[model samples]
Target: MSNIPFTLHTQNSAAINVSLLYAASSKYEGEWSGTPHSHPYAEFFYVLRGEIDFQAEGEPYSLHEDDLIVINPDVNHTERPRGPGTVEYVSFGVEGLCMDPADSGMWSSCSLFHCRQSRSEVRFFLRLLLAEFENNLPNYEQLCCHAFESLLVFLKRAHPQELAVTAPKRTARECSAVKRYIDANFRQPISLDHLAEVSQLNKYYLAHAFREYIGLSPINYLNSRRVEEARVLLRDTSHSISEIAGIVGFSSQSYFAQVFQKAVGESPGEYRKRLRRGRQEKQE
Candidate 1:
């Protein structure tokens, strides 16, 4: 046998960095349609079971199991179950990456990688990533992030030219706007969907980013704001608990009392009475 020497050299610089915004699994049954919305970062969907009818920019495509779709940024799309059966899929919001499916004339702004022929790796990575989230063990964030990067690497290997790395822009301005809106409208009915529409962000991503920056989820922050106002009313004004609850935008006094008790140490009435007792003792 002849001896042969082979050495491979590669650059040490880093490439293909992606930030996982959010990853989730969903199962839909019967007739359900999502509102058409667009985001600033690329979104991905992998059909695990059943069929999904996806509409992007008014173009409809029937996606079956093992079908992978990568939607570029700012492309309005919606999905629903194709038929009577249930449609289950895993979705990911990825920042710092974009897809250019120029070779496929049929898919204009998005690329569809048909994984029917070879789907084992895709299935494995997604299943493992979701399990990490479901289990939420120690250092699950790091594990999930690595799993996400592995899945992205697989996509890049499958279609080298279609995927490219781009850093995700910071969303400080948008997050600030959401905070301002919540501060102004805390006395009115608010929901996550409304917040998503206001910020033009996917709700999941918005919630994640808001929590990271503000230390609380959007709805939680809103409730905190309401509770803050309720405390002021409880201390300064002699309004009834029910009246104060209505003034702070709570639908029912019981819910307001429950939330107030959770945030503070005691119920609203108890808090007010304690304050009154302290004030009377000071006067005496």
Candidate 2:
């Protein structure tokens, strides 16, 4: 019998502090039910079966089996079944980690990678981490976290040009500050010029950097915030549509309706009516 030898080496490295917040596996049949939304943490997805289409930051991409994607914080994205087959995938919500590419042509917020050659290895880590989370035995959380960090190491090695995990740049920090400001004062008459004054960054650079870091231009982000608040008010309050529009910082109801439809796929009145109808049906 031939003998094989293996050696292990150790090197100094800084600790990457990341917490695996959650993991989920989903299978969607025909008539997928997904909404455009975003979160403030990094998310990872691996397609296990079939094809799916992902719209991230207004760009469309079709992904097949053995493919993975990483989305940065505050990036708007949605996914649905592609073609005619069922879609199955596993996703992980991670915090305290961000990814940027060494080259151009790939948005740091939405990075897609095809992994046909490393399918088995990729699936192994994903499935293992998922199983550990599902099992929830002793030290399962620790195990899952370790597995996820190891998976990141593997991915960086495999996609060196694409997965250069690094700290947030200065611009990203400034953009984040602006995002927080918007969150607090979206109902005000905020503009790019005002934001520039607040952040002390140029208007053009602030717009571009905000989009690069947050996945939407400043105005777009403001509009999205207004839409989100409008949705809540429509569902909960009996306020008139126009009043809601003005309260959410829109100049006119017509413009509010236009932006709301583009973001939510329905007019505000229609959404409110549908919600009320559902509530009435439940009560009846």
lDDT by residue for model 2 over 1-284, one digit each (tens)?
Answer: 11111221112243455556778799877767669887776789899999988976656888899889888777778988877778789998876566777544223656788888877777888887888877778877666766676776677677876656644344755676687688789999998999999999999999988887667899999999999999999998989999999999999999999999999999999999999899999999
TM-scores of the models, in the order given: 0.49, 0.59
How many steric overlaps does candidate 2 have?
0
Candidate 1 lDDT for residue 152 = 61
Clash count for each candidate, listed in order shown: 0, 0
Whole-structure CA lDDT of model 1: 0.76
Candidate 1 ranges beyond 4 A from true positions: 1-17, 102-108, 167-284
Q: Which ten residues in a row have the lowest lDDT in candidate 1?
A: 1-10
Candidate 2 has an lDDT of 0.78
lDDT of 1 at 233: 99
lDDT per residue as tens, model 1, 194-263: 9999999999999988875456899998999999999999999989999999999888999999999999
Candidate 2 clashes between residue pairs 3 or more apart in a chain or in different chains? none
Clashing pairs in 1: none
